[model samples]
Target: MHEFQLPDMTCGHCAGVVGQTLHLADPACKFQVDLPARKVTVQSDEDRAVLAEALADAGYPPA
Candidate 1:
């Protein structure tokens, strides 16, 4: 599992976009987003750097 702190994620819409972006990157991955906490926990076989890059490319770079 990979945990990321996304300081820019301020609302449900942000979370939804992040979720959709990650899902598109790796459909089999599982993840949970905590909007209030500005955190995201992802479970996937993909490399951490790759996942992080994907999120960054989608405009939700981790803090």
Candidate 2:
């Protein structure tokens, strides 16, 4: 799994946006958003950098 640490992702809305962004990038991806931990764990065939870039372009750059 690819884990992203989103420092500003702190709410359900952020999680939803993250989900949408990831789904747009990789429809087959499976993920979980942990708000308290500010983390997003993704299982995808896409490269980690691709996923990270997608998230970054969506304004949630991973740490």
Candidate 3:
């Protein structure tokens, strides 16, 4: 699993965007988004860097 702490991901809308970004990055990936903690946990075969890049490009850069 890959975990990203996205400080900017503060609401349901942000969570949706992050989910969409993850899907675009890796359609087969499964994920759990925690808006309260501003974290995203993903289970996938994709590279961690690729996921991170995708999230960052979507305006939710991980910290």
Q: Estimate each model's TM-score.
A: 0.95, 0.97, 0.98
Residue 62 error, candidate 1, Å: 0.6
Candidate 1 lDDT, tens digit per residue, 1-63?
999999989999999999998898889999999999999999999888988999999899999
* Clash count in backbone of candidate 1: 0
Candidate 2 scores a C-alpha RMSD against the true structure in Å of 0.5
Residue-level lDDT of model 3, residues 1-63, one tens digit each, is 999999999889999999999999999999999889999999999999999999999999999
Candidate 3's C-alpha runs over 4 A off are none
Worst 10 residues of 1 by lDDT: 17-26
What residue runs in model 1 are displaced by over 4 Å at the alpha carbon?
A: none
Off by over 4 Å in 2: none
Question: Candidate 3: how many backbone clashes?
Answer: 0
lDDT of each: 0.93, 0.95, 0.96
lDDT of 2 by residue, 10-59 (tens): 88999999999999999999999999999999999999999999999998
- Candidate number with the higher TM-score (1 or 3): 3
Worst 10 residues of 3 by lDDT: 32-41
